[model samples]
Target: MSSPLSVILTQNKLTGENFNDWKRNLLIVLNFEKHSFVLAQPRPPTPAIDAPDRDFVALERWDNSNLSAMCYIRASMSNVLQKQHEEHQT
Candidate 1:
């Protein structure tokens, strides 16, 4: 018999100046992987008199039958994020 697959629960940071573009790319990645996710926005402990805080996209749930898909999603997302980081660095 084969061992059961493990579920993946992870978060992707959504930062920098191009939030909309980053989010759109991440959505595409998730859709391609057929994975459902939740968008988590950072909230301050109290009303911030200054600016807003950081945010993230969380993949907290997955289909147990296809855990391997998460691996592909993670790799693709990592690549996308790295590209975005490099672009911002320039």
Candidate 2:
């Protein structure tokens, strides 16, 4: 049997001070053949933030061969982050 491969898709956001400005960036990190790679998604670049830094991020891993793996991985990561944020609010 072959070992499973994994990939991570994440979105990182930087928000300005006074919560007045925001920008979101997407990244993908893959793990294959015992090596890792980081790629920036082909999307619009984040605009400059006007205030102090805040971060929002997510990460997900999945078996590379499965159909719809990318979608599941992304959703899992987002759900995890959402739960974390909700916990912090309490």
Candidate 3:
């Protein structure tokens, strides 16, 4: 079965023209999922080889959240918008 998030996104695909509304909806879902930190905080730089364990952990969490959030954003975007953003680094 499709996920609730997929259902919401299917109902309100991001078409660029409704960017503000789409962003609001997306933020609400991300926050509810506890993945909003990836967007709220600046990404921590790659931890050094000698970095503390906590640093490594933070980076891992940030990386996971970034990837997950990006996937959700891309999934919700209109096909044209998704293609246009396919090469974006961030």
Candidate 4:
């Protein structure tokens, strides 16, 4: 099948106003989960800007934590997901 996976890819652009409301908070949680499972594992490492230091490693670790949280949050929405597999011609 050559069909592209039609996943409900939500681009959550959370703002300070969203955080102030409870309903938006739930959406934040829901969106995080959908993003993590549907999408592939995100890259954690960043390019060296000035020099390689512990700060960079710490930043990377923080990003990894965010990624992990995203995956966990997305666990609830796995049922309605649409997965597509590309079929190649031999």
Each model's lDDT? 0.38, 0.28, 0.82, 0.39
Ranking by lDDT: 3, 4, 1, 2
Candidate 1 per-residue C-alpha lDDT over 1-90 given as tens digits, one digit per residue, 9 for 90 to 100: 011111221243444555565456555554545443322222223434453433111212323313433343343345556565443311
For 1-90, candidate 2 gives per-residue lDDT tens digits of: 122322222222222231222111212222343212222322223434553233111111112222132333343344545455443311
Error of 4 at 46 (Å): 6.7
* Candidate 2 Cα lDDT to native: 0.28
- The regions of model 3 sitting more than 4 angstroms off are 1-3
- For residues 3-78, write the lDDT of model 3, one tens digit per residue: 4665676677899899888888888778776788988798999988998999999988988888878888888999
- Can you write out model 4's per-residue Cα lDDT over 1-90, one digit (the tens) per residue? 011221221332223344344235434453454433223345445767885687587666656555544443343222332121112110
Q: Candidate 1: which stretches are off by over 4 Å? A: 1-15, 37-90
Q: Sort by TM-score, best first: what order?
A: 3, 4, 1, 2
Any runs in candidate 4 off by more than 4 Å, and if so which? 1-48, 78-90
**Which ten-residue region of model 3 has the weakest summed lDDT?**
1-10
Distance (Å) between predicted and true CA of 13, model 2? 19
RMSD of each: 12.9, 16.7, 1.9, 13.1
RMSD of 1: 12.9
Candidate 1 whole-model C-alpha lDDT, 0 to 1: 0.38
What range of 10 consecutive residues in model 4 has the weakest lDDT sum?
81-90
Model 3: lDDT equals: 0.82
List the candidate 2 regions with Cα displacement exceeding 4 Å.
Answer: 1-3, 7-38, 41-72, 75-90
